[model samples]
Target: MTTVAVFRPADERLDDAVALLESLGATPVPDPMLEVDPTGVCPREDADFAVLTSKTGAELAEAEGWDAQTTTVCAIGDPTADALRAAGYAVDVVPEEFSSGGIVSTLEGRVDGARVEVARSDHGSDVLTDGLNDAGAYVHETVLYRLTRPDGAGESADRAAAGELDAALFTSSMTVENFLAAATERGVREDALAGLNDAAVGTIGDPTRETAAAHGIDVDVVPERADFESLARATLAAAE
Candidate 1:
């Protein structure tokens, strides 16, 4: 059985990823790399459009009683859209590309001369805001949360360093960065990176793939869809 490493936050998402791996016959190493630290902030109410980049952002926004007022709501992907809808917010846009660049494209012509509010975590890429600004939209970003790596989060790094991990699913660039931070803290950065490179690795999107590449980690798979199941199955197949 493949021994795979995952780094989702400690939540239903992590549980679901583990369950999915088990259902697929892989032994999972659920090493959560992110812990959400809510910033107690919400989207600005005066914007013409509001964009949510993650399910966590949507949940936080909902908890803050964010009202659309006169703004159109948008999500970066189906997951975020579902979360917003579940919270009783009407999702008006979900880009086909399911990424910052994709959302930029989706709102390009429409957002010209519009006030766009972006609600997301602290580590959100500048691409979206810059793209929107360049496209003639006044963009304001609210940091809804900050992602911090939990203490003692490097066990999977040790396992990887020992050549025991068969695959790794990197859902975001921050996961890759936090995983490296964990490995470095364990004093196994070099060995862990070497072993990790030997195993099959999948990144959910191009941004994550690029981040891994910048660190000299060769990503073996990047599924067509930027989702966990697709990334895991594709990486496991590559590992075999």
Candidate 2:
């Protein structure tokens, strides 16, 4: 039986990945590699536009009393836009392609002189903010969450060593680092990575590919876009 390991944290949003794997007749295994903490980050205010890169960022903004009425919100993809809309934000833009480059491109002509505030995890890349700044838009950033290594490293690594997973999906570079850390902690680094090689290694975008390659693991698939659905379809194609 083929088993697909999901390396994201345990969240209600994982339902899509779980359902997708089930539809492909692959065993679904939840091997969360990281955890999200909403504390320890500050929020910013007063901007022409608000950039939301993840659903977690949306949740954080909602928690921090950010009103969407005065700010035009931009989402990285449809799912994030959905989250923003549900949070009562007026989502003005959602790129068809969900990568940072796509988001930047979508905002090129749209935000020439606008002050854009970016809300994201503490360790997130600065590609969006930097690109926006270079495009003549004043960009402010708010780190609303932090990602930590999971405490269940041993168990997750043991499952990898047992050869139960046919593949592992990585949505971000942090996920790659955390998964490798888990494998190292369990003293099964070689076995875990070998299991990944035997099956498939799925990356959401170029940055994720770089992260996987730095660990000497050749990524097997990268979706055209960086959304969860695109990554899942790429993983399924790689499995076939």
Candidate 3:
């Protein structure tokens, strides 16, 4: 059986990553590198616009009672938009690229002189802020959640060092950083990465791939779609 290393944060969406691995005939090694903790903050419901980059942010918005009836809601991707819709928010914008650049493009003309509120992860891209400001929107960015290193981070690093993992799935830049920290703690940072160099390296999107590259890991598979299921299929194919 193909043992795939899962290095995403432990969250509601983690099950989706595991399920994708199973569907692709891979045994998931659950060594979550991070966890998302809410900052108990929300965007202004009275703002002219709101931006959401992740499901966690959307959930936080819902918890903070951010109604979208008056605010123009913009989501970075379909998943985020779906979360908002499920919470009874009407998403007015969804980028085609599912990145900060995409969000910037979507709000290019509409944000000038507007009050834009962004509820997102602490580690979210600065592109959105910069873009909004450049477009003359008074932006208020709130840290909705933080991604911190979680337990069992060293498990996948250890397995990689032993050549037991067939693939390593990286869903975020934070995952890459935490995985490396785990490997470093095990004194197998080089060996683990070397082993992973031999195995299929799966990345969720361009940002994760850039993070992997910064660590000298040339990704073997990058999903055409920036989602876990696509990442799993690409990893399986690359491993084959």
Candidate 2: 10-residue stretch with minimal lDDT: 151-160
Least lDDT summed over 10 consecutive residues: which range in candidate 3? 7-16
lDDT per residue as tens, model 3, 1-240? 789998766665677778877877889998888888888876777789989988878888899876678888899888899999999988899988888888898888989999999888889877889988999999998888888897656898988889888888898888898999999998999989988998999997788899999998879988767767777888888887
Every candidate's lDDT:
0.94, 0.79, 0.85
Every model's TM-score:
0.98, 0.91, 0.95
Every model: Cα RMSD to truth: 0.8, 2.0, 1.4
**Model 3 pairs in collision:** none
- Tell me the tens digit of each residue's lDDT in model 1 across 1-240: 999999999999999999999999999999999999999987899999999999999999999989885889999989999999999999999999989999999999899999999999999998999999999999999999999989889889999999999999999999999999999988999999999999999999899999999998999999987778899999999999
Give me the overall lDDT of model 2: 0.79
Residue 105's C-alpha lDDT in candidate 1? Answer: 97
User: Higher-lDDT candidate among 2 and 3?
Assistant: 3
Q: In model 3, state the lDDT of residue 31.
A: 84
